[model samples]
Target: MSNALELLKTRASPKAADLVPPGPNEAQLNEILTIAARVPDHGKMVPWRFIVHPHETRAPLVEKLIANFRAGKPNANDAEAEKQRLRFTNSPLIVTVVSKTSPNPKVPDIEQLLSAGAASMNLLNAAHALGFGANWLTGWAAFDKSSKELFGLADNEQIVGFIHIGTAKGEVFQRPRPDLSQIVSKR
Candidate 1:
């Protein structure tokens, strides 16, 4: 099969644990980001922003995530902390897609939000096409309004997802997909 067709067919997000080092280098990363931005933006309103978190920031982010998690759930345990630590650190790069839906008379914020979601999907697709394992994840850290400063997000901006990019430790297996009959309906 053609590369494009193969990617469309075989693309599945590997677990963060399965995602290891040797991710896209500088040039590849630039290419991936470039493609990620090539999504549908209604009325030329680029309502999304990408926050590329460097590897060094992972530890600090994890620390804050742990603190916040503990604050919210005092009953949380070490396993949960370790899980967050791995989620932030297992990947070589983390790109947080922020949806800054601006007030546009012509372009609704809903459309802009969709554009941001498309951009996130494009990021995942581009990374997979470039031979990298990518995962689009969102958790409590994404919705914690108090932690906007930690993520460098503005009051008007909300996180769409945290895109994790890295090399696959082994390989990804295909999971069950919904059938078209179950999802589609005739007009």
Candidate 2:
């Protein structure tokens, strides 16, 4: 198989908690973001943008996420709050993909959303190609309006996912996948 096909077939997402440090450096991050932006953008809408959550921001962001969680769930216990806090600081690099969808006459909102999804996938693939383990995740923070506002997301913007990039702690075992025959259909 070709190299690209081989990479695609072998790429796997390591668990966020299992990811270590030594994430993409400044230059490598630039390249990854560049690759991420090269996706289908019908009507040139460019309806997606990235928010880089660097190391310094991790602590503050975790605090904010914890606050948001508390506000959203008043009765949340310490365990729940700690879980939310860890979500922000688990990985060395966190890139939040924001979908800035707006009312456009030429392009439908669904198409723009799809473009954002493609961009996120591109980001994951780029990180994997760069020899980093990456995982795309969306949890309470992604759906919580208060959390979104705290992340500086605009009213029209929504979080597609938070892409975590870091070094793998150990070898990642391949998980089960659906067979082509089971899912594919000939029209």
Candidate 3:
């Protein structure tokens, strides 16, 4: 019990966007992703997925996203437009977790979404435990139809998060956790 509790107590999540390049190489990243895949999947459906945007190839994708964004919002200024472009190209490695929406009546979409979320959190934790930083973020892109189409998501698929994983370029501060009493309920 103490060992399990100790690990929980020491677990720290760094700002994933703050992560820099030269992250875990291909082999290491693959190993970590493989570890993350071992999550609790209801009905063995594997209703979640991952897409890696490596640093080398992120520029084109980022440009594509920015262009798509501009198509929808033609009047965006330079700074505003640049922000959208940096989201993909900024990180050394961006791993997107996509939730697969299904028509299973017994297993609600909420549960499926939660499963995807768990997978994302696991990916972050797995990377951190392996001496790396990870941040999961989503803005206009996650819900943007054009962006989803660019990512090649299926009709029933939606993005759960876009996780940035790499080395820490700056200090990672730990925020205070909420009191358990505020959230827990007695049966």
Candidate 4:
């Protein structure tokens, strides 16, 4: 098989906690974002943006997230709050895909949203191609209003995903995939 096809077939998301350091450096990150931006942008409307959350910001962000989680879930125990605390800090770097849909007469909102989704996938693929493990994820924090405000997301913007990027700490098991025959249909 071709190299591109081989890479596509082998690509899989590693668990966030299982991801280690040595993430994309400055140059690598720039290239990765460049690759990520090359998506199907209809009407030349780039309805997406990326938020790079590096190591230094992780602690403060996690603290804020934990507070938000506790406030939202008053019944949550210490363990649950701790889980929230470790969410973003588990990985060395996090690239948040933010969808900023605008009023467009030519292109619909759905198409712009798809572009954002494509960007997210592209980021994951780019990280993997650069020899890093990445996982696209969104949890309760993604939907929380306080968290969104903390992230500085505008009213029209939404969190598409939080992509964790780093080296895999352990073995990455390949889960079973659906057979083409089971899902494919003849036109």
TM-score per candidate, chains pooled: 0.93, 0.97, 0.91, 0.97
Judged by whole-model lDDT over C-alpha atoms, candidate 1 comes out at: 0.87
Worst 10 residues of 3 by lDDT: 4-13
The segments of candidate 4 whose C-alpha lies over 4 angstroms from its true place after superposition are none
Clashing pairs for predicted structure model 4, backbone only: none
Cα lDDT tens digits for candidate 4, 1-187: 5988988989999999888888889999999999999999999889999999987668887888899999999999999888877777889899999999998999999999999999999999999899999999999988999999999999989999999999998877789999999999999
In the range 136-161, model 3's lDDT, one tens digit per residue, is 89888898999999999999999999
Task: Give the higher-TM-score candidate: 1 or 3.
Answer: 1
* Residues 83-109 of candidate 2: C-alpha lDDT, one tens digit per residue: 878878889999999998889999999
lDDT of 2 at 102: 87
For each of the candidates, give the backbone clash count.
0, 0, 2, 0
Best by lDDT: 4
Ten-residue stretch with the least lDDT total in model 4: 55-64
lDDT for model 2: 0.91
Residue 116, model 2: Cα distance from true site in angstroms: 0.7
Between candidates 3 and 4, the one scoring higher on TM-score is 4
